[model samples]
Target: MPEPQQLEAYFALTEAVSLLQHQVEQQLRAEGGISTVQFQILMALNGAGQLTMTQLADGVVYSRSGLTYQAGLLEKAGLVTRGPSPEDERATLVAITPKGRDTVAKVLPGHIEVTRRLLYEAVPAADLRRLRDIMSRVRDHIREEPPRSAAPRRRRTS
Candidate 1:
């Protein structure tokens, strides 16, 4: 059985993350005219230079189709480009455009402000390090298997 403290911790973490995400997403949409998700996609591609669709989805914690839709928005805005991967005809690649980099540059200040206010200010310096360590371990454990929502369902035969 799971311990009570463990259960409490899990719920607390979920609540905190959900609340923080909601706040940040709203702030980004209102102040920056982009969703938090769009910012994440841009951030990943900007930092990595380029990534395949599957890689971008995994990096951004989104389903391939969901990534496609969000990438479409970015592309429509001229912030990103999606095209055939040079090395793989069967794969599509996503990359940040100069405008996308510019968008990140514009959005980063407000993003950092909200993030700092909601998260960094809430934790001590030492606790922030501990939080990062704990979250990294949790992220690794979750990535060890298929995502529950997007994973293919198993077949059963009697």
Candidate 2:
């Protein structure tokens, strides 16, 4: 890839992910009656069985307070339960409810269909392994770095 194309590629990939998220968000809301963030929380909890409040927030890229608010909503909907961690009184553990599992089951077909339409169909099967390898490497590289905001800014001079 050329230098200029690399820049365009970065923006293109970002936009593609954003657009895919929007499409999935709509499907989740229409079919499962959940927001993208809620679906993300449920999805993570579903896979992990249970996670600490800190873990949940980190996995979903949400702040602790934000996760608390969303968790409250999920709890009110009877989709999840939050309780004190047995290992640590100060920590909260979140687990999915039966209703949350059912919601995931109901929404999975649409989710899969949209993912296929947006991604699987676009990439050739022969290159999928390579694509996955590249994506994983990129994710790891970025994940290892601190957020841009956490880095100090250089001094400005007139």
Candidate 3:
């Protein structure tokens, strides 16, 4: 286990991230009928034009099944559609519909405003830059590390 100071720092950072996520999610939910995860998936599709389900799952922090469920719901809502992949018939591709794009356009401005107010307005430009640099480095380091044996695996157990 980490020492007390290390644990405290971890807790504090985790809480901060959670709070930010919650706030953003609440704002998105209030404006759109969709959750932040759904909004993110839409945004990814809008940005990328089209993506495989696996690509969408990687773009967002969603489990494959969870993303599929969300995509199914979105499809039923007329917000997105899945089609056969052009490059690989075996793979499926997901894309945002015009309705989805319009919905995202309607909500994106408010989302950006809230993000700017919560993050940018509160920090000095230099500090924000430094923070971004530090976070990027940390993300790279973690991604480069081998999967830890002790890491929790997502599997059902009887």
**How close is each model in CA RMSD to the real structure?**
3.1, 4.9, 3.3
- Expressed as tens digits, the lDDT of each residue in 111-142 for candidate 2 is 99999999889889878778899999997887
Give the range where candidate 3 is weakest over 10 consecutive residues by summed lDDT. 144-153
lDDT of 1 at 128: 96
**What is candidate 3's CA lDDT for residue 36?**
89
Better of 1 and 3 by lDDT: 1
Relative to the true structure, candidate 3 has a C-alpha RMSD (angstroms) of: 3.3
Predicted structure 2, TM vs. truth = 0.85
Order candidates by TM-score, high to low: 1, 3, 2
Query: On a 0 to 100 scale, what is the lDDT of residue 131 in model 2?
Result: 83
How many clashes (backbone N, Cα, C below 3 Å) per candidate?
0, 0, 0
Clashes of 2: 0
Candidate 2: segments with Cα more than 4 A from true spot: 1-3, 146-158
Structural similarity to truth (TM-score) of each candidate: 0.89, 0.85, 0.86
At residue 29, candidate 1 shows an lDDT of 84
Model 3 per-residue lDDT at 149: 29
Off by over 4 Å in 1: 146-158
Q: Residues 1-158, candidate 1, lDDT per residue (tens digit)?
A: 89999999989989998999998888778766889889899999889988888888777888767889999999999989999988999889988999899988888888899889999999999999999998899899989987643577467888
Per-model CA lDDT versus the true structure:
0.87, 0.88, 0.86
